[model samples]
Target chain A: MAELSEDRIAAYAASRLPGARDVAVSGLARISGGASRETYRLRLRYVDADGRSVERPLILRRDPPASLIETERHIEFAAYRAFHGSPVPVPQMLWLEEDPAHLDYPFFVAEELTGFESSPGALTGEAYDPVREKLGRRKWTILGEISRADPEALGLTTVMAKVAPEDCWRRELDYWEGVLDEDEVTPQPIIRAAIRWLRANPPPPAQKISVVHGDFRTGNFLYDAAGEIHGILDWEMAHLGDPLEDLGWGLNRIWCWGQNDLRGGLLPRDQAIAVWEQASGLKADPAALHWWELFNCVKGQGIWVSGAKAWSDGETRDPILIISAWRMFNPQDRAALELMGRL
Target chain B: MKPDPDAVLGYLAGLMVQTIAPQVQPQYLAGVIGMSGMLLGMAAQEWDRAADRLVKENRAIRGLFRQAERVGLDADLAQEVRALAGGQDDDLRISALESVNTGLRAALISLHAAVETRTDAASRALNDAIWAELSASTSRRAYTGSPF
Candidate 1:
């Protein structure tokens, strides 16, 4: 529990609701296993203007003292708004409070879509065995729908800085490589070598400056036994950039959590791409996809190293950070090596 | 040797995390204590075999570096290889062995890269050796919870 107690949350809710009374919050328990944000599930009960009692389940995602990836809450809120009620399902975001007075740090509240498993290992279990293909189709198809969305029309361009098609690769590469340079505790010769190679062979200008769901992959979505994806979560890294960037990220080998060539612990890599291509009506140019694939390895390594640095520096004290850093570092390096054709 | 130090450390770590940390206050301290538990767990896994793994890997890297020198290589890289190959872990401390290992690995990467660009059969064979050493090095460092 944070300094802001359940009473404070209820008080805040009462103020937001014009005719509500006796606004109370209960069942305020923190959900385990989020390194970037502290997630809590609570129930909000209040008497409405009609004198009817209403209850709603809500989730609070508060910014941690330090995070694995620094991201904007507003961008995630805007991304939710952009996808809600569309083919790409997302929880409806209610409030984004940037004021530290409310909570020591920025936070956002959204509808809690319960009754679904989101773990990467869950998808590989026997319970989901029958619906694997269906889930796979929905996963990539929703990504295709995201790729199909217009950033300008969705008002994302105003929030996500627009990048030139050719500059997209450079901007993303530079940013992630910068993270690696800043956070690396040890020499990463493999990643350093890959960075050099990426610079030597930059991808072609993006086919379209589509919205890139920066961390779009397995374990980032809510799914059930019926092969339905309820909500796309973790849009904190959402931005407008090369669409192929998302495709490449999805195709990264690390997301092959099932330990197969298939991506996202779901469908085969080519099949997943096929679904995306068919839905978005875009060709995944081989050379461009290859560059982005290798670039993602660099990006992944950057994220893992940053996790290690965050733990080492004592900026954040979360077990997930330690778990992430130790588990992902060497694998990320190996992925980079494989991408650079060294393995 | 009867009750392995590694097993005892791991048991103590489990006790600290599962039995003790939760009872503490100031959530931040609990997290620190939890991480200390993890460090202990990792240390327990590493403690007993650290010297053995380092010794084996140092010997392996030295042999590879010597093989690299036998190949007709660029003079500067060959000298670098010769210098690394001639070195030994004089100080038996884990930190000292680690320092020497880091130096050898860095040299290995350079040698591997050098041989990667060459067309000679000896360069190719040396490249294979370097890759094997790199693979072995990762395996040696791999922990129980590693994703790979």
Candidate 2:
């Protein structure tokens, strides 16, 4: 795999756009921190149908040889498309090319959301500190919109597989546990113990099946200094499941980047839940919410172990894989134990 | 040892953030170097206590496993526990201790699951001890920068 040159990418783009002329690409540089996909930012120049020259900043996300999470790109592309102009903001998906010949791998292109901070650390800085409350409100408010939106009505059901309202917990638990069963390099007594307890004591059926943004926590969105979220990114794990699953994931202790019990480093867990409940019109039964909270720990462990496996297999030499495996594996187990009352 | 592991890593972290990271091309590699520096800092924090913690935990687990034998655990589990309980650390190397620790923990998980469902008071007590040790194990590995 030689470096992905702008000329090559432009050539690929030109073939796709039949009426386009003077297709050129520049500023093609890889962006860091996306372990699951190869992300790049570039400026696309081309002539449109009216012969007007245009240069637009775009983002390219291509599948790596292996990923931290094995997800279908088509689903993610469809997910972004579904919520593009809705209350739950997302980037405009321009094209999805599955053919390997395009850039040596399947990739998707979207309008690059620019000039906005995406790191959670940015939220703790001076500029954002004043608007912390505003950010938190908008954060949960957007998530509430996602929970409140009807997947079938948004045409998401056509792309995402349907799940029974009652079977959401079982499907997620089984999938994550199966991953641990296959990829765990060592024994995970805490998570294994949590799994047994979950099976023995299951949560009630979901209030309703909603679009569960499987990874809707802080640090996965683009926000400006004024507390406006420009885009909700990373929908690779998005699926149709229990709404509380997304809510519980947002409350996972790992996202408490501020080293406190404040959920998502913004509001108290209960307050965040209340805001979400108020907006989504869903009841977050304490016991059921607890079940999903622990389940997210298992899911976290599964992701970390999968990243370790990817690194050990020599598929991707990205250090985030190793860092996640080393730093998160134990913390995730500890989270599970804390939730289980065993810590 | 004169300069100290933390001091060395602290200096390297400065170099990464201030000098090396700024000069790297292909932004991903630069970010990797920055993260690698952070990993070095974590490794420095672990370096001094790595061997001691392993030794302490190994001894602690063997003690728990020996107690498991007295609770009338199944023959296979008892034999495994007895063998591990009588084991001694022949090598002081961190890697050697870590290898032994991994084997011990694998056995510990089995012993815990075996005794968790038993009806006897002794089995219940042994299970509680296992859970307590597991909790302590996590605390020992916890770092100042841990998100949890």
Candidate 3:
């Protein structure tokens, strides 16, 4: 893989901006905790055809040699573009380059939503105590907006594969289960049992096939001290599926970072669900939501094991992979057990 | 070997977080150092418990296999269960115990799936026992301060 450099980024920016001169890239630094991609924060400066100097802080996400999850970059780009100005907040996507010849790997650049916090650990501090509830409300409310939005209207269906309402659970379950089958370093008897339970008691067909932001947990979004969400990020796993899948993922117990009953370490589970229901104008049928919650646990385990496998196989040396695997594997199993009423 | 590995690792983790991470250049490297500290802490916790956990779990799974005979599994599965149940964790090395543990757990999954199909009272009792064991397995692996 080609190493990311200021000159290479400048060259790519120059190519993208026709008639622009003296293009320069500076302050290029890789950011932390994006196990799926190599994310860099850089400043782009150039003189455009209009004879105006343009400068902007941008984020560059390039495909790594091995990723925690396999996803199509273009589809992720399209997802951002689809929701840029919508009710759901997302960074403005600037460019999507698929030709690995340009930067040694496919990548995309987007406007950096700076001066906000995204760490789940940050939310656990006393500084955020006052705004936690407000942030929690906005969190699930935005998720509800996403669940209510039509993939066809967002032009997402064109890029994302379409799925029937009934097959949403099966498709997602199959994909993640196959991930476990391929990448699990250790046998996951608990997840296997959960899978069997899910198959035995399938949820009612999705009320509607809405865009499922494959990962909608607390840490995936940017928030302010005032408890307002500035941008929703990490849509690499976005797809057309049952809207409840997103709901279930958000309500997962593994996200309760405070070690309390607060879902996502933000709001009580009932309050979050109520906020979501009110915003999306949809009913979260208890049984169906329960089914999706347990299914998300299985999906969660699949991801943790895959990271462990990637690290063990010498595919990537990123410490985040090993950290996440070690920290999350058992909690994920316990989450599954709780959901299955086996805990 | 003068100092215990867990103590050394714990001290190293504190050093990384309290000293090295803050001094590291480039935000990315700093974050890596901090997380490396966390991984070391987890390793420290697991080092003392891995062998004990694996041995106890191996014995528990063998017990389950023995009790599974009443469920009337198929010939091949029955033979496999019997073979695994008869074994003991004589080699106390972590690697050896883990190897045996994996095979036993795999067979346990097969037994679990088969047992779920039968509706007899014996099957029901065995199924309950399996769930109890599974729940206990999570308890055995649970880390202190775990979110769950």
Candidate 4:
């Protein structure tokens, strides 16, 4: 199959905007590092239904041939649409295309949250030096808003599977462990140990179930120098589970960006938790949070191992997979060890 | 071999990321080129150390099995550990060494778990030793660019 052409995208946009004329898609450049989707930024220009000239910048996320995580695009679209204009800032979802005949893959187009940096490496630099604390506060606080959100209220319950608070931990653990089982090309002794430990000791039921931003980490969000979080991206992993799961994932040591002391390379672990606690108006419950944090190590490893398996098996040759495997495998183990109090 | 393999990889990686990636059209492919370069960089680092790291780690894990035998693990686990403790990575090929390493590490997990169960002082000491070895194992496999 041929790669998707920009003209085809413009034609699809024209079809969607029935009354719009001269629908053109330009600047369709693919952004790197989205292992789960083919993300592209494009400039869309057209004359609207009112014969009004309009120019807009948009992001197009289309499904790839095979990806690390399999998720429902509709769910992601719904999650973004649900969060639009809410406390959790997300790009306005414009159109969701499930029929592949137009673009050759299921994709969604949304208004791009432009002019912001999303690189984790940039966060470690001197540029974000001034507002690191403020950014950290905003990061977890927004997570708090997401955790405090009601799926039913947000019309997300229909798309995201409903999970009871008590079973949240088990459900997530089983899913990731199963992935490790099928996808692990190498024996992950540390992950296997972590899994047994997780099963042996499970976190308490969630305080209250909230919308879990399945991949809520510093790199997933749009941050500016003034310490503002414009958008919380990557809802492909969005689900309803223990809110602590998201909190733990953010606090996962693998995200420390080589600075083990600074969780997510933004704030100290305790400080990040405190900011989250204050914003969520909930307790971190040291023991339960610790369990979730360790569990996230296993989850993190599962993702990396799967990426390795995918690349090795020739399913996809995305260098990101090799990077994830080579770059993350050890850090994940170290993180697990630290969480287990063995480090 | 006159030009060091690592140096060659480093040069290629630099060109790919600095020159090729920037000049590539359609940002996604550019990004792939950039990351491929980075992957090459990491591959270079791992290539030189792969054999030494695997040999040292396999030896360390085998030594741990010897300690597990002294601590007196479960009958079945002890038997397995004892057999592995006397084993050798005679085949020094990376693939062969990795195969042995995988089995040894698997047995180590079993030994570690069994040691955790016993309340004996030796078991406690052995358990701690296993953790130390495990920590060392991760450090051996460490990629400089790892986030954690």
Candidate 5:
């Protein structure tokens, strides 16, 4: 594994850009907080085919040796490319390399939406107080747009495995349950019980098999001072599943970062639902939505426990795994309990 | 032991989060260091209560197993619950206590699932008790910085 030097990245970019010269990858320092990938913000400078100098900010996401979740980089790149110019604000994906030889691991590069905030802690401050409601409205409205998309038209059907609307719940539930069974270092009695309940009573067929942004919580997107979401990032877990699944994830109580009653710490739960319904032109059936929300809690636990297992086994010594397990697991259980009416 | 373990951890965590993290470049590493600091802070909090919480929850789950025996359940499940109820956490080490807790809670899941199928007063009472314990367990392990 070669060191991730600027010279190496510059050479790789030069190779990718035909007829381009003086390609330099600079300021290639990693930005923190991505548990699944090593994310970095870099500057790409080059002379284009027209002999004009060009410079742009870009993001590099490379697969880690082990992570909280497993996902396909090509599918993520395809997802961003497909939704690039759509109502959804996804950064334009520029290059994808699967051959780990280039950077010692598979990675993809996309245009960075610079100067936008993605931290939930930042959104809850006095600076954002005035526009929190506006941000919430746009946040879920964008998700609604994603739910309303046609997977086949977006070329996602080919990349993301197709699933019958009726089988969506079973597929997601089984996969996450399998994750829990394999990765849990300790017995998860609460999540296990929730899984049993989810199996006994399943949600109805998905209204549509839209792209579920496997993680659409508050911190995953880029926002601004005026409460605008510039880019919907982190499509690693994106797949074709229930539209309500995305909605349910956004509405999960664990995301209430403001420590208030607001869903996503932005809007009331009903208000968020109404905004989504109006935007997607789809009804959020109460029972089915409830089922997905609880299922997401199970999924959330699976992810947290997997991180714990990865750390416990010395697969990765990253402290983020420990932080995630300590902060997330208990809340995930409580969220499931709340959905089950046992809280 | 002169300086309390928890106090030492707190000082180390503060250094990482407040002092070292801010001095680092590449904003992401700083954030990671900051999170490491927060995790250590929470760990310092957990250090004092780990064994006590595990033992108390283990005893509480064992008590539920005994109650599950009274609530109508299948022969195998009843036998499992009775066997769990008969056991005790003789080892107070956190690792031993947690290992025992896992087994007891796994059996409790089976017992709870069995009790859910029955409609008698005893089953309903046991169901209520199970929910209460699960809720209590979460609260017991609740970190001060819990997202909820």
Candidate 6:
């Protein structure tokens, strides 16, 4: 792998901007908690074709050699592009480069949503206490908007794989179960039992096929002290599926960062569901939602173990991978058990 | 060792989080240092209890296997369960105990699955026992500061 430097990014940016001059890149510092991508914050300076000197703060999301999840860069780029001007609040994507020769791997650049907090741990402090409920409402409302939006209208159907309402649960369950089979270092009897139960008792067909943000937890979004969400980020796992999938993922018990009954350390489980139902204008059938919630536990374990496998194999040395595996593995199991009424 | 490994690891974790992380640049390295400190704390917690946890868990699974005799599994699985049931944990090393534990747990999954198929009272009871053990297993491996 070639070393990623400021000059390489500048050269690439220059190439993208055909008539730009004095193209320079600086202040290149990596961001944290990107186990799937090498995320960096950089400053780009150039004199454009319009004879104007421009300086912009941008984000670079480059593919690592190995990642917790294997996803198509083009699909991720398209997801962000489709939802940029919509109510989704994603950063405007600038470029997507697949040729690894320029940056040692495929990467994309987008405008950075700076100066906002994205950590779930930050919400635990007293400073965020007053705004927690507002943030929770906004969180699920944005997710509701994402779920209710038409994939065909957004041009997402062209990029995302089409799945029928009935097949959504199986497709997702099979994919994650296969991930567990391949990556898990220890026996996952609990998840295995949950998988069997899910297969035996499938959920009803999705009310309507909608965009499922593969990850829609509290920490994935940028928020302000006023409890407003600015950008709903990390759409790398975005796909077309049952809309309830996103809600189930957000409602997963492992995301209860306060280690309490509060889901996402924000709202109580019922209130979050209510907020999502109102925003999306769709009913969350209790039984169907329960199935997806349990399934998300299996999916969650798959992600943690995949990261553990990557670190164990020496493919990447990102401490977040090990931290996730160590911190999340048991909670994920416990979450599954709770969903299965076995906890 | 003059000082205990748990104490040394705890001190190292504090140094990394309170001392080293604050001085790191670029913000990302600081976050990594902090997370490393957290991992060291987890490592310290595990160091003292790992061997004891594995031994107790191994013994518990062996007892479950002993009860598997009446579940009437297939011949191969029954023989396998019997064999595993008779085995003892003579090696006190964590690695050896863990290796045996893995095999037992893998077998436990098979037993649990087979037990689930039978509708008899004994099979049902054994199935519930397996679920109880599975739940207990998570509790055993759980960390003190887990977000769940």
Q: Score candidate 3 by lDDT.
A: 0.91
**Candidate rank order under lDDT:** 6, 3, 5, 4, 2, 1
What does candidate 5 score on TM?
0.97
> Where does the lowest 10-residue lDDT sum fall in candidate 6 chain A?
A253-262
List the candidate 4 regions with Cα displacement exceeding 4 Å: B18-20, B71-79
Cα-based lDDT for every prediction: 0.83, 0.87, 0.91, 0.88, 0.89, 0.92
Give the CAPRI class of candidate 6.
high
Best by lDDT: 6
What is the C-alpha DockQ of each candidate? 0.24, 0.65, 0.75, 0.73, 0.74, 0.80
Candidate 5 off by > 4 Å: none
Candidate 5 lDDT tens digits, A89-155: 9999999999988999999988888888898988778898899999999999999999999999999
Predicted chain B of candidate 4, TM-score versus the true chain B: 0.93
TM-score of the B chain in each candidate versus the native B chain: 0.88, 0.91, 0.94, 0.93, 0.94, 0.95
Q: After superposition, how far is residue A261 of candidate 4 from its true place, in Å?
A: 2.4
Q: Whose lDDT is higher: candidate 1's or candidate 5's?
A: 5
Which of candidates 1 and 2 reaches a greater lDDT? 2
What TM-score, computed on C-alpha atoms, does each candidate reach? 0.86, 0.96, 0.98, 0.95, 0.97, 0.98
Over B1-20, each residue of candidate 3 has an lDDT whose tens digit, in order, gives 75989889989988998899
TM-score of chain A, model 6?
0.98
- Residues B1-148 of candidate 5 have per-residue lDDT tens digits of 8588888888989999989999987787788889889988998988889999998898898889888767767788888888888888788888898888889888887877788767899988898999999999998998776788
Computed on C-alpha atoms, the DockQ of candidate 5 is: 0.74
Q: Which lDDT tens digits does candidate 2 get at residues B1-148?
A: 7888777987787788678987998887788898887778778778888888899889999999889866987788889889999998889899999999989988988888888888899999998998888888888888767878
